[model samples]
Target: MKNYILIICAVMLSQVSSAQTSQTADKKAILSVLKMQRLAWSDNNIEGFMEGYWKNDSLKFYGSNGITYGWENTLERYKQAYPTADHIGTLSFKINDITKITDDAYYVMGEYHLKRNVGNATGIFMIILKKIEGEWKIIADTSS
Candidate 1:
C-alpha cells in the first residue's frame, strides 16, 4: 500500500512538472511576439506591427479614443494616428504579467512607451491572445 501511494505521488509530481514546462514555453512564445511588435513599431512599419494581431473581422482593439473592431479597421486607426515616422516613434514595452487562461489562450498586462522627436507618451495595456494556426495572435487589446 505504501509503495502504491509513493508511485502515485511520483506520477502526480511528473505531471505538474510537465505542465510548468509547457507554460514556460508558451510564455516565451508570447514574449517573442511582443518583441517582434516592438521592433516593428520602432522601425515605423505599421503593417509589420499589426502582424502580431489576429487577421480576422472579429478582432478588437480598445484605445484611448474608443473601441475599434476588425483587423482592417485597427490598421486604419493606427495609420490615422501615426501618419509619419515622427509620429510612429520608437516603442518599448514592459510586460507586468502573463496569465494562461487555457491551453490555447493567454492574457498579458504591460506598459508601453513611445519616444519621438515630437514628444513621448506612455500608457498601460492589456492584451488577450490565442494560439491560432500554430501561432500566437492577439485577439483583443485594451490600451490606455
Candidate 2:
C-alpha cells in the first residue's frame, strides 16, 4: 500500500515536471520566431519576415488604418506601405510581455523601432501566435 502511494506520487511529479519543461520550450520557440522576424525585417526581406506569420486566410492584422484579414492581403499591405528598403530600415523590438493563452497559443506585446534613410518610426504592437503543425506562427497582430 505504501509503495503504491509512493509510485502514484512519483508519477504525478513526473508529469508536472514534464509539463513545465514543455511549456518552457514552447515559450523559447515563440521568442525564436520573433527574433527571426526582426532579423529578416532588418535585412529588408519582407517575405522572410512574413515567414513567422501563419500562411492562412484567417491571419489578421489591425493597424491605424483598419483591420486587414488574410495572409496574402497582409503581404500586399506591407509591400504598399514599405515599398523600398529605405522604408523598411533596420528593425528592433523591445518585447514587453509574452503571455500564454493556452497550451497552443500566446500573446506577445512589444515595441518596434525602425531606423532608415526615409525616417525613423516607433510603435507598440501586440501579436497572437499559435502553434500550428508543430510550428509557432503569428495569427494576429495589432500595431499602432
Candidate 3:
C-alpha cells in the first residue's frame, strides 16, 4: 500500500516536470520568433519580418489606422508606411508579458521602439501566436 502511494507521487512529479520543460521550450521558441522579427525589421527587411507572421489570409492586424486583415494586405501596409530604411528604423521590443493561452498558443504584450533619423516612434502591441507545422507564427496583432 505504501509503495502504491510512492509510485503515484513519482508519476505525478514526473508529469509536472515534463509540463514545466515543455512550457519552457515553448516560451523560448516564441521569444526566438520575436527576436527574428526585430532583427528583420531593423535590417529594413519588411518581407523578412513578415515571415514571423502567419501567411494565411485570416491573419489580422489592428492598428490606429484600423483593422487590416490578411497577410498580404498587412505586408503592403507595412511597405507603404515604411517605404525606406530611415522610415523602417531600428526595431526593439520591451516585452511586458507572454501568456500561454493553450499548449500551442500564446499572447505577447510588449512595447515597440523604432529609432530612426526621420523620428523615433514607440507603441504598445499585443500579438497572438500559435504553433503551426511545428513553428510559431503570429496570427493576430493589435498595436497603438
Q: lDDT scores for all predictions? A: 0.97, 0.96, 0.96
Off by over 4 Å in 3: none
Residue-by-residue lDDT tens digits, candidate 3, 72-105: 9999999999999999999999999999999899
Q: Candidate 1, which segments miss by more than 4 Å at Cα?
A: none
State in Å the error of residue 66, model 1. Answer: 1.5
Please give, for residues 35-137, the per-residue lDDT of candidate 1 as tens digits. 9999999999999999999999999999989999999999999999999999989999999999999999999999999998789989999999999999999
TM-score of predicted structure 1? 0.98
lDDT of 1: 0.97
Model 2 regions lying over 4 Å from their true place: 1-8
Q: How much is 71 displaced in model 2, in angstroms? A: 0.6
Candidate 3 residue 32 C-alpha distance from true site, Å: 0.7
- Evaluate candidate 3 by giving its C-alpha RMSD to the native, one decimal: 0.8
TM-score of each: 0.98, 0.91, 0.97
1-144: candidate 2 lDDT, tens digit per residue: 999999999999999999889888988999999999999999999999999999999999999999999999999999999999999999999999988899899999999999999999999999999999999999999999
Better of 1 and 2 by TM-score: 1
Ranking by TM-score: 1, 3, 2
Q: Could you tell me how far off, in angstroms, the CA of residue 102 lies in candidate 3 after the best superposition?
A: 0.9
